[model samples]
Target: MTKKGGSKHLKRLAAPAFWPILKKEYRWVTKPSPGPHPLGRCIPLLILVRDMLKLAENAREAKRIIFDGEVLVDSKVRRNFKLPVGLMDVVSIPRIDVHVRIIPHTIKYLWYVGVPKEEVNLKLVRIENKSLIKGNRLQLNLHDGRNILISREESQKYKTLDGLLIEIPSQKIVQHIPLEVNKLAIVMDGRNAGRIGRIIEIQEKPGMSRRKFLVTLEEASGHRFQTILEYVMVIGDDKPIIKVSEGT
Candidate 1:
């Protein structure tokens, strides 16, 4: 008989570079089960607990902790150890009072930044796309597989790449930050990944050029550079609504 489904195992060498695991020391690593985020952009909950958070000594311990309903993703209990935890997702362990939000890193593809107790329920999600849906409502597709419905009139206020501050679980939109000049933004990918700065200028081209829309960003250090609009995520208007850096 042929294999029925995808492989349950992932070789360490084949794991994502952002995963902080020994490549050669181990033959196989836990493969993230299909979830909201894609395999390349998210980390398995088991690996996150055991390796990144250092809350568990081994896979067994991590599984135990997760099975006990001690782990909460987005303010809800998540028992699946293979659950994918991706960007802007909150992981909380009430017992240990641990809370962290995954964000883009300059070196690693992703990194976890501590979240304050008060802000644990808040999350920032980018508007990947939007379209008209049933009832003539506009549906906003967020980066993390979430969809928000709004009235057609409200749709005019939002655009792709805009950031929405939402309440987890409830998912109520608290604020919307547009991607415009003078707005604070972060590079989500490319060579300048994880760099946060203010948008200074936007150059939109008409042709099929690879760089169709380039945005110039000025960092706090007074350095300015241009990157594709696809790589830029508006974080705030002046300063970031939340702490995105370790120092901040």
Candidate 2:
């Protein structure tokens, strides 16, 4: 048998520094293309299973588990080791009774968090774009690259940046959370990543150089932090719509 000819290794220097791995020791690593998650914000499924989760001893073991239809991402079995899993995405291994969701972290860009059984199918995705299709149907482009189409009338209530709580496998919309003042949000970058708070105020900068709007977040303990609009992801109105717990 012959191996594939394409490059399968990513340069350690070119990889994202925030990734939890020994950067200097390994000269090459897996580089995944744009998939459910963006390139820089996601890690390859192989490294996640082998190195992060310690589920498999090596890449070969990880690939075997995935190919055997034991690894499910977003409720669907994924065999590709290079699949990109990002924030808010759920990972499940029924055989081990283990499930986790990727969440943002201040120190590490993203990290895995344990997800209870009841919350395994729930995921929040932000509306990144909206467009009208040929048959008068409205198309919603999600932050994770998933698309959903509905009637124009049905989509009237949704706007760009709004969050939708969807049930996996079925992809049914269970809740719609709007992006506005007083809504609950989480900082995704720059100083504060996992801090959950309510939106106190939003300031739009029309003529700024590269920065746009700024959002003010007020934590439960009265602490406040300001971040660029793009650095936050709206997750709820009064509180989080799903369960979040740190994994071992």
Candidate 2: C-alpha lDDT: 0.83
Q: For model 1, what is the C-alpha lDDT against the true structure?
A: 0.91
User: Distance (Å) between predicted and true CA of 223, model 1?
Assistant: 1.4
- Residues 9-68, model 1: lDDT tens digits: 899999999899999987999999998998888999999999999999999999999999
TM-scores, each model vs. reference = 0.95, 0.91
Give every collision pair in model 1.
none
Q: What are the runs in model 2 whose C-alpha is more than 4 Å off?
A: 1-8, 206-211, 245-248
Best by lDDT: 1
Candidate 2 collision pairs: none
Residue 152's lDDT within candidate 1 is 93
Per-residue lDDT for 6-28 in model 2, tens only? 55568978888777677888788
Q: Give candidate 2's error at residue 185 in angstroms.
A: 0.4
TM-score computed on alpha carbons, candidate 2: 0.91
